[model samples]
Target chain A: MKIAIVGSGAIGLYYGALLQRNGHEVAFLMRSDLEVAKRDGVRVIRTDDEFTLDRVAAFGDSEEIGVSDLVIVSIKATANQSLPKMLDPLVDETTQLLTLQNGLGNDQFLKARFPNNKVFGGLCFVCLNRIAPAVVKNFMKGSVSIGPSDGADASEAETLVSVFSEAGVKARFEPDLLGIQWKKLVWNVPFNGLAIAAGGVCTDVIVESPELCSEAKALMEEIMAAANQFGYTFRDGFADYQIEITQPMGPYRPSSMIDFVEGRPVEVEAIWGEPLRQAKAAGVAMPKLEMLYALLKRICK
Target chain B: MKIAIVGSGAIGLYYGALLQRNGHEVAFLMRSDLEVAKRDGVRVIRTDDEFTLDRVAAFGDSEEIGVSDLVIVSIKATANQSLPKMLDPLVDETTQLLTLQNGLGNDQFLKARFPNNKVFGGLCFVCLNRIAPAVVKNFMKGSVSIGPSDGADASEAETLVSVFSEAGVKARFEPDLLGIQWKKLVWNVPFNGLAIAAGGVCTDVIVESPELCSEAKALMEEIMAAANQFGYTFRDGFADYQIEITQPMGPYRPSSMIDFVEGRPVEVEAIWGEPLRQAKAAGVAMPKLEMLYALLKRICK
Candidate 1:
């Protein structure tokens, strides 16, 4: 399979390199890391295994990687405006467009822009960071949940999951795309938003403070409530499970927090704004998420 | 009236100096600013008028100030624990106690500590800062509202208002202490909390952004809702009025925000926590205030 990786940040570089190692022809669309990818060629540093694709194809222009079988978008949602132009050269009628971006609306955005291509969305439950140019670090290689967006077939999402599995990754296909998004947001809305909103602290700080912990759970409950309006029901104690799972990720910097601290544009619209809007439109009141969204927009701006 | 001012922050210095300049014997119970106050007295710099009280008595210990006709408590709510000890020497059965602190519960604390003494609570609507030791700058000399706590008489509050009015301060006698606190919190909870929570901004920053402006209004509405449960009703468009009045202040930092940015303890309990607890007890749901209180507790901690 020939795959084109767009917005080659940490998720893009790590996953793209893995697919390339598994014999898939992978080409990365790079920006600041283009020269580094050509010279050092995308290094993935993990605790157990470290590898580098020394001479993989890296292009500055999307047209050079034209018409791939699969196009994986891992860009920050702040730069979603460039998606149509970038994906135009790589997307064909048969090409599957999988967005590995955070928050809601990315898959919807892709589906709207490239109506002919099959659109899928994947939520990466991994702790990965690009330490330096073309140099990726994986603190936790968690699984990925791939789901077909509206009008996309479930079997296509399953095929993409199998592709990830072949590259030594834990990937699962989810039929309900919106449900999976709310589930992921149950964690992201609080942890990612609070990490920056609570003065650039980390998961540990939030989990340690009783006030912050309860606030996080409240945010999760609000997300769950909004999800319920869309026919998605979370089991009782889901919010507790989310907090419990985050306890071990001590002082972990969320990707959004990293973006905010490093002076990069955050995906405020996609992550916080869109969810609040969708929840309101569904007639579900998410006061906590709404306030958090307002704060994030102000801080990120 | 012979008055003793405790915790000589901006509010303490400005008001205390005014009374002393008006020929009343005013003694300041100071800490770091004791020497400066004793040397150069206290200076109040305002847009219209500036005055200095030279050779005024400045005592490091409240005991040295002795029992006074009135004792003004101007400390941060974070230091409320030290009240009993500090007030012991300065407060007698005839010594009236007036707490000009932000938020709720200060008057209650005083009433509990000194049951025989008349307890009064004053909410100062001013923009004042202690720029240097014993030197206070007042950008706006907004009025103060005084009201008696439980068991205190309305006439007593009126007398305190006269004391303030004698010193050329625009002081009003409010019959409802809790109502005034809630009314002030309609502005404080969002403006003060967001100023710190939104990366240490000012009132202008909160008013400028549409998201933040709406958030401030929502917070005000939540406060009004809670106030309604307690038989307090605000005028229509009160939130808009709060924002409109704040717009002309242009980047004015709230006292709590100043405390946070200067590495001093903020009055999280008095300003946010106590009100939230009280509102919940009153069967009023204030999700915005609850979340803001949580963020403030974590950030200020």
Candidate 2:
């Protein structure tokens, strides 16, 4: 299989290295790391395994990596605005695009931009970071949650899942992708929003402060309530379950916190804004979320 | 009448300087600023006038100052925890205590400690900052809203009012002091909470972001509604009225912003925590304020 990684960030590099190690021809759509990745290849440090691809194709311009079987759009959600212009060149007749980014509207945005091609959304359930150029740090072993986007057949997603699962990624298909996205939001909006708005700390720092930890839980409940308004519901204690799981992660900086510390604008619109708009349009009372969105919109930009 | 100024920060020094200039025997109950103030009196740079009192009494130990007719508690709301110990030595039989700090419960807290003395809560409607050791910068001139804390005779507040007004400060005694405190909170909770939570920007920065400004208004309205539950209702458009008045201030950092920036723990309890608790106890929904309080309690301490 031939694959093109639209973003050379940690998620893309990690997955790309895994697939490349599995004997697939993988090319990276890079910016500053283009030359370095091509010269020395991408290195990934996973908890259970560590590997480096000796030589891989890299392109600073997406047009140069034209016509791949799979195009993984793994850029930051803040970079989604450039989808049409950047992804336009790499997709071809047989290319199936997969959006592996955070927040709500990625699949919709990518599908709209690549109308003639199939686009699936991939949620990376992993804590990873690119510590340096062309290098990825995998904090824990995790899987990719895959699903077909609108206009895409379900079977098309299986091949990629099998490829990922075979490469030890534990990838699985989430038939209810939209439901998965909202479920992910139950954790994302509160944790990510609190991390950024509350002095750009990590999950560990958040829980260390009892008040913040409570607010984190309150925010989660609010998000769940909003999701229920649009026909998506989670069982009782789901929010508490997330907190119990997160408490042991030990000072993890979610992507939004990273954006803030690096002085980059956050993906507030994708993660919080869109969901808030949907809640209000559906006549749901999501005051906590409305507050989060309002504060973050000002704080991020 | 003899006056002792406690917690001599910006507001303390400004009022102390004004009263000292008006021929009162003013002694400052100081902490770190005690030495400098004694060496070269308290200096103030008002918009209309600037002066340095060449000779003024300053004492770190409240016991040294003995008792007085008036004791103005002008410290940061965060430091109110020391009032019982620090202000104890400065009160006498006729020593009327006045609290001129930010937030909600200073009056309650002080009155509880100094049950023997008449207590008044003074809302200083002025923008001021402590620029140097003993110097304060006055950005604008406004009246101090004076009110009795414990249903004491209104005239107890008038003594300080007359002194303040005589020293070129606008002072008025409100028969409904609790009502004034609640009304002031209608603006304080949102502006202060937001300034700290939204990256410590000032009021002007908040209003510049249309989303933030609107959220500021929404939070204000929520607080007003909460206030109304306790029978302290404002006229219609009060929230908008606050916004229109605040927009022209040009990025002024509210006290909470200063505290966060200076690495001081914010006065979350007095300004937000107390009010949020009250709102919930009354069965009033103030989700926005609750959210703000939770985040701030974590971020501040």
Candidate 3:
């Protein structure tokens, strides 16, 4: 399989590394680290198996990468406007473009850009960070739930999952990818929003404050309520479920907080704003997400 | 009239200076600035008239100030826990205490502490900063809406207004003080919370961001909704009304933002938490205020 990673961030690097090790031809659509990656491999720091891979090709221009079997769109959603133009040289009719990005509108965005190409979405359940240029730290999970965003019953997703599984990645095909995205947002809207809202405090600060915890839970409930309007009903106590899973991370700050600290623009548009927009379009009153989106917009870009 | 100004911070000092200039026997219950105020007196650095009055007495202990006819409690609501003990010596049976403080619960707090005394609230529409110990800069207005908080029409409130008026302060007695508190909160919860939520940016930034302005306006509507449940139905577009008044302030930072910047504890309990509690009691859902209160609790305290 010839696979190309769209953006060389954490998810892009980690998965691309695995795919490359599995004997797939992988190319990275590189940025400023283009020279460094070409000189010395992209480094993956892990407790079990840490290695640097210089075997894969790194291309600064999308034209140099050419059309591939799979193009994983892992760029920050803040850069969505440029994705069409950036990926134009690489996407063809048979190109299976899988977005491992955050937010609701990416599939529509890509579809609008390349009408004939098969656009897939993967909710990458991962906690990783790109600490330095061409270097990524996989702190935890890298499982992906993949499916076709255009409502196609995907035997195509199964083939993609096999390639991912061969690379030692946990991959599964879900028929309801949009529902999974909504489920991800139940956690994303509250935890990511609250972390930034409290001026970049971590999970420990949230758990310690009863009001914050309840507010987090309430935001999750609000997300579920908004989902229900779109005929997507999550289980009861979904917020608590997220908290129980996240509590083990122990004083961890999420990606939005990390962006805030580094003076980088946050992906609030993709993660917070779009969901609120969809909720409003559905005539759902997600007051919490509305306020969170507003706050994030004011603080971030 | 013999008046003792408790909590000699910016609000206390500025208003107390006006009273002293009006020939009232004013004794300041000073904090860390006792020595400086005693040496050079509290300085009012106004553009029109900046003066240092040495004739007014300044005392460190409330016991030294003794029981006065009127005790203007201009302390931060964060100091409410100590009010019972601190104001014990200064508040007597006839000591009409006017709380020129922020938030909803100041009168109730003082009433809780000094049950025998007349407890009133002054929703001060002022913008001033204490640049140094006992030195306050009046940047803008000093109009106070004075009234009884417990829905009692007391004649003392009218007298208090007259004294405040004579002291060159724009003072008026509002029979419905709690409603005014809610109206003020329509402004407070948005500006104060948004300022800190935007990483401590001022009003200029908030006004510039369309998302923030709409969010602030939405929060105001939520507050009015909550107030309506308590039989306080304010007119429609109250949010717009407040914004029009605040837009001219030009890059202003509210008191809560200042408190947050100085690392002083914010009055989340009085300003945010109590109103939320009341809203909940009235079976109202103020999701915006709840989230703001939670964020403020995590960051400020």
Candidate 4:
């Protein structure tokens, strides 16, 4: 499979190198940083492994790349508004457009942009950080879930999973990817919102302060309730499970938190603001989530 | 009238100099840093005026002081735990002990410790900072409300108002001193709790984020409701009035906020923890206050 990974940040570079190492043709649709990476190749540093791939293709413009079997969109949530136009050159009838981005409304926007293409919903449950232009450090091991956006046949899902597994990336095919999306949505809206707002680590919030932990939990519960009102059934303890698993990931800060600390634009609208809008539209009372969204919006502004 | 002022910090020195200028025989209860002040006497730099009073007695130990007509206790709230014992020699049966300390539960503790002495509630609404050992800089002019803690005769209240008026301190005597105390209580709990827990300034918390502002307002409202349940009627728009008056006070941080920045022992128990306990006892729900209290306690730990 020929894979083009867009927005060549840490996640993009990590997966692109893995897929390339597995005998698949992987290219990066990158910005100016990729020019240096093209000459020197990409370096990935994981806790369990480290490698430098020198045969990877890098492009500044998506138009420079030819057609591919798959295109993974892994840009920051704040960059999604301009991503569709940037990705126009990479879309074809058989192109599988997968978005493994954080936030709630990216899938809808992607669908609206590429209606004819097979857009898949994806969520990555790992922690990775870009230490340099071409170097990414994977701090934890987690899987990715992907499925057809509009409930299509399972053949494409199986093929994508096989491609990911063959590349040493754990990927699962979910029949109801929306459920997983909402589940991820519930966790991010509260944890990411607070981590950005409070300027601290996750353990500093969850372990040190029971009030903040409980409030964050209540916000997640409200998001889950809002999702249920919209015909989604979240498993019990979904929020607690995410908190438990993510707490041990040593001093890990969410991307939104990192963005705020670095004085960059945040994904308040997608991760928090849009879900709050949807909840209100569905007549579900999400006071905690509403408060978190309003707070994050104010911080972003 | 003879008056002895204990805990000669900024507020303490301000009240002491004011009382001395009002023709009262005033003395300051001095600490180690105030040794120079004890030798040279007290100095006050007011907004409209500045003066220094010589021959004002200063004593390090309360046991060395003579009896007084009034004893003004103007220490920090956290220091109030050992204050009653410190005042053992200066406080007589006729000496009315007025606490100008910030936060709740101080009066109850004072009354408990000095059961036979007259304990009056004093709430100061001014901004003063100690610039030097002998000098206090008054940045704002505000009133002090004083009244009997046990709802006794109005004579003690009248005397307090008269003394404060003569000393150039805007002072009023409220028959329902508990109501005023509760009003101040509501304001301090939310702003102080948030500022301390987040380790930020008041305006930084209130103006930078709508979520923080709303959370603050919710906490204030919960405290107000709890106060009302305890038979106190607060004036309308109290919280808004406090925010308006304090926001432009020129980047002034609350004491609790200062404590967090300085890593000092915070008065979390008095300001937030005790009121939460009172609310629970009064059968009033205070989710926001409880959460804030819990967060501050954890941070302090």
Q: What is the DockQ of candidate 2?
A: 0.73
Docking quality of model 4: it rates as acceptable
Give the candidates in order of DockQ, highest first: 3, 1, 2, 4
Query: Residue A151 error for model 3, in Å?
Result: 7.3
Give the residue spans of candidate 2 off by over 4 A: none
lDDT at residue A252 of model 3 (Cα atoms):
73
lDDT string, candidate 2, A1-301, tens digits: 8899988888889898988888889889888788888788899997777888889888888888878888888888888777778877777777888988888889998777778888898888788888888999988776788998877878888877898898778889877677778888887898899898887889998777777787788778777877787677788889889888888778888877887888877888999998888777878777788788888887887
| lDDT (Cα, tens digit) per residue for candidate 4, span A1-301 | 8888988887898888888899988879888467778888988888888999976799888888877788999887788877877787777888888888877777777888878878787788778887788888898868888777884457787778888888898899987776777778766776777676554445456544667777778777888888788777877778888778767775777777777777878878878877788788989877666555654666566
| Candidate 3 residue-wise lDDT at B148 | 86
Report the C-alpha lDDT of model 4 over B1-301, residue by residue, as the tens digit. 8888888888888888888877888878888546788678778887788888866788888887778888888777777767867888887788888888776777777778778778888888777767677787887888898887774458977888888988778899987766777777766786776665554655555644566777777777888898798788767997677767766765666666766776767887777877788788989976666556654666676
DockQ of each: 0.74, 0.73, 0.75, 0.24
lDDT of 3 by residue, A240-294 (tens): 8888887777777787788888887789888888888888888888877877888
Best by DockQ: 3
Fraction of true contacts retained by every candidate, in order, equals: 0.74, 0.81, 0.86, 0.19
Which ranges of candidate 1 are over 4 A from the true structure? none
Better of 3 and 4 by TM-score: 3
TM-score for chain B of each model, two decimals: 0.98, 0.95, 0.94, 0.90
What TM-score applies to chain A of candidate 3?
0.95
Going through the candidates in order, what is the number of backbone clashes in each?
A: 0, 1, 0, 0
